[model samples]
Target: MEALKEVYSRSFFEQFVKVVKREYPPFDKNRFFELIYDQAWPDRELKMRIRHVADVLTQTLPPTYEEALGILMRIAPGCRGFEYLFLADFVELNGLSYYENSIKALEMFTVCASAEFAVRPFILKDPDRMMAQMLAWSTHQNEHLRRLASEGCRPRLPWGVSLQMFKADPGPILPILDNLKQDSSEYVRKSVANNLNDISKDHPELVLDISKRWYGHHPHTDWIVRHACRSLLKQGNPDALGLFGLGNAEGIDVRQLVTSTPQLKVGEDLIFSFHIQNLSNDARKLRIEYEIGFVKKNGSLSSKRFKLSEKMYPPGTSSVSKKHSFKPITTRVYYAGQHKLSVIINGREAALVPFDLMDGNP
Candidate 1:
């Protein structure tokens, strides 16, 4: 597979220059290419390289923003792949002064690549005005634009600036989510769900209320509610669990819970086993999961839950065993200490076990 950095390669610049030259006859394709491929040009990272190309466009394109924007409008329709790189660059370059125009440009640019990160600065600068525009975009005929409308304003948008105001109080974004809740495109709906999920991190009750209010309205809306409540479900919040019919396991019995190793090094695996039996006479729905309480630097424990299985449990016994590797991963830092593990059935903790972690270093 080609590396992502290759997206801004010489060929990409050549294709982009070709498209620009078609609309702007005086576009100095050679000089533009030379500037982008200059010996000093840092092609080491994708984002930095994309910014370098944008800088070249600023130097080579028409001096005035409108003239350059007009040329971009023509060039944009023909641009493909990571062409949104240029559009996003344009937004970041001129968004403050040409906020309205940048919003319009992003509507076109997002269909090619996401403008979610591009629009965030404008939201942070003038949230009221920018979010008002986004609310209007929620009903846009273009699914990409509608998705951008919600995705851009996400409180915790990855790779984008955090919308802190929304994090403190997400009331302002609720209307935008409401407009797109029943959106025709799953793309738009998914963004709405993610936006809500971000809010759930800061304001759980607000998300739960929205989930309750929006439940059963439409099948698509139901999906949004479920996805929005994911974090709450992972934490085994009772309301969130009840909403998904994964409440307490009334007639369930957990037995034979054991760990393969009571102590292991960071690179080793921690295996476990368990058995569950349904005490109820009739069939019962169950959502089985496991939680691992990782020891943090402060001697406190932070738990992460993983889904094990979910199905109907007839009046019989079932056995399950699994292995979880504790290999070093970038996302988590393993500290040498005692950790806790628990079995969760229908959002109820049925068993708990402790294990010791050791650093491989001598």
Candidate 2:
């Protein structure tokens, strides 16, 4: 697979230069290239490279911010996808002082590539005005702009800077979420759910209130509410579980929980099996999940949960077997040490088992 950073290759810049030169005749292609591919260029990661390109544009484009934004607005529609988000980042890097022009540029740029990250700084700069603009954007005719309305203001947006004020008091964000709850675009709706999910981490009751009110109103809204409460459900919050008809695990039993081996090596699979029986006289809903307590470098454990199944279990025994690979992935670093695996049924732990993880080829 091509590294994500490769999107800004020489070909991309060659094409981008052509696009900008058409909008602004004075665009200095040679200088832009010279400055962007500097000594530190290769060492820069994805976001650092994006900012480097933005900085280079500041030097190569028209002298003033407005002139540069004018060029950007004309060239933006031609630029599409997450790779072109440097256009929006350029706005965040240089357009804050331009205020109205910056907002206008963000509105235009988002049509092609999202201004989600760009808009957050503006929200922090002037909460009332920027949030009002965001509210207006919630009902935008374009799906990307509508999605930006929810995505930009997310309290804990991944990769984007955290909106600490919103995390503390997400009241300003609620109106925008409400407006986009029934959005026609699934992309926009997902952002609304994610925004609510971010808020749920800090203010669970507020999200629960919104969930209870919106869950049954519309199918789209229901989907948003269910997804928004995902974190709460994983944490075994009774209210969140109850909203989905997943109640106490009083009658659900884990007959046996066993791993293929107590000690396993990296790049190997930890096969496990268990039996579940329902003691309840009637059929009951169960949300089954597995928890892994991974050892950290400091010898502390960080618990991560993976959902296994959720279905109606009758008053009988059902067998389940699963294999968890210890394969290394970019998102998580695996440490070899004592680990714990637990079976969770209906938000309650039914069994806990220990295992040992060894280094490669052990």
Candidate 3:
């Protein structure tokens, strides 16, 4: 304990150590001190020193996500660009409080969009809170908060939420979509579109339900529906196909597309698969595309599209397959929500496979 105090020596870790030493010091003294975590209190000199620590620690990264979580929690929000590093550190840590903090601090963050962008994996670990906040965020007066609602609920978030878990439940984000279906802000509305796109992965009917109704109520809904079902509209997914009225209207038709599992852990890959067949007595040229969406720690959804698979297939094919792999570099939980794998033909909707996932921390 005394040795740690001496080593802290007016550093960021010093302040925390001073406080902890006076109260309840750690028993794992030698090894714990070895885990260098300098605080960043927003001071010019100290901030530079803090950055140095971050650099040094980067090489000796935590062996497990749990250890990284604790190191980030102690940062004082000071130092030079410590916040980002702090976030990256949390990614390494996979911290619980990091998720909550990301939510609470979303408004304060200048990079709210990016922070919102970075929080999915942490939220994936705690969907209960993530879902609750997404619903509540929808009602917030601040556009950012409202944006968080729709953005966080998305089934596929670009560079954010893991897609595997989203294929499962996608239910938590429903209310947020309902609230933001007609949002005024283009930014927020775009998030809504992406959110819907994510949901379309697993719940094409639901996406269409909200989308069709949304289109009826507001003009903005058109953009959302179009963007949400981009992959579907491009090739041909049955649900998307039927919703958009692209293929044969009054013949033997394909069933609805559904995805299960709606949560994902960092460093994990989400595997999505679905059934497909042709009732027509001809070969189908299917162009399939899949996307991964995420729920930020602050209850926003961001989407990153991935090409799951695309090809020209013969009639009567039972299924198509694709997978998305991710390493959550932040303490963000990806709420497993609806996922969409859409099939299209010459820019027309044909079929869609919808599902959810649960892949975030482990």
TM-score of each: 0.85, 0.97, 0.45
For model 1, name the residue pairs that clash: none
Model 2 per-residue lDDT tens digits across residues 1-362? 77799889999899999988887877778898899889998889888888888889888887889887888888888898888888899999998889989988888888887889999999999999999999999988999888999999999999899889998899999889989999989999899999999999999999999999998989999999999999999999999999999989997899889998789988889899999999889999999999999999898999999999999988889899999999888878889999999999978999999999999763
- The TM-score obtained by model 1 is 0.85
Best by the TM-score measure: 2
lDDT of 1 by residue, 264-318 (tens): 8999999999999888897877888999999999989999999988877788898
Off by over 4 Å in 1: 1-3, 25-49, 259-271, 294-302, 325-330, 333-340, 354-362
Q: Which segments of candidate 2 are over 4 A away from where they belong?
A: none
Q: Tell me the deviation in Å of residue 123 in model 1.
A: 2.0
lDDT agreement of model 1 with the native: 0.84
- In terms of lDDT, the best-performing candidate is 2
The global Cα lDDT (0 to 1) of model 2 is 0.91
